[model samples]
Target: MRVLLCTFIQIVMWCGYSIVLFLSHHDHNFYETILMLMFGYFNFLVAQRLNINKSVALNMTISLTLIYVTGKMIIG
Candidate 1:
């Protein structure tokens, strides 16, 4: 249950972050990178508390990277 909730929160947060960045015309500046990293850190905390496997963190990083890269490609 906790794992599911953590996954859901992570997905929602990523989507919200991406939407905000897209709408704001962000240029992937320092602040945007910091915000992204913060979200990753938050996910780490939640996953840790839920006693989830470490691979979840890797998966989150990979997933976010892919989404960000794909969005950049499509937007450009």
Candidate 2:
């Protein structure tokens, strides 16, 4: 149940991040990158608390970020 919840939270955060990127026209300044990294770190912490594997959590974070970025680019 916790794993499912964490997955859902990550997905929602990805979507929100994608929307922000799209709105900003993908300029992606340093601050935005920092913010994204912070978010990823938060996700990692959540996954740790939920007893998820570190590698799997990291993989999911990278994959979701890539997926959202690709989607934003393709849609724009």
Candidate 3:
């Protein structure tokens, strides 16, 4: 459940950022590289805060990534 919530937050963080960037110039893929690192950092934070295993953190990050992708699709 905590993992799932982290995923949601991850998606929301990216989506909110993407939308704001999109408003300026529509460079959607521009944020991917940065988000990759961000996700890594976030996963570390998740592991620390949630005291979860690496696998759980990774899976949760993936779920969150999916949310970002789907959100952009739905919104755009």
Which numbered prediction scores highest in lDDT against the true structure?
A: 2
What overall lDDT goes with each candidate model? 0.73, 0.76, 0.65
lDDT of 2 by residue, 18-71 (tens): 677668865757967887787778877777878888887778777777776678
TM-score of candidate 2 to 2 decimals: 0.69
List model 1 lDDT by residue over 1-76, tens digit each.
Answer: 8667877877787788878777877465887878778877776776777777788766755576567668877987
- Measured by TM-score, how close is model 1 to the native structure? 0.61
**Predicted candidate 2: what Cα RMSD to the true structure?**
2.8
- Give each model a TM-score: 0.61, 0.69, 0.53
Q: Against the true structure, candidate 2 has what lDDT?
A: 0.76
List candidate 3 stretches off by more than 4 Å. 4-12, 15-28
Ranking by lDDT: 2, 1, 3
On residues 1-44, what C-alpha lDDT tens digit does candidate 3 reach at each position?
Answer: 76667656666666666765657564456565565567557655
Per-candidate total of colliding backbone pairs: 0, 0, 0
Question: Where in model 2 is the C-alpha error above 4 Å?
Answer: 18-28
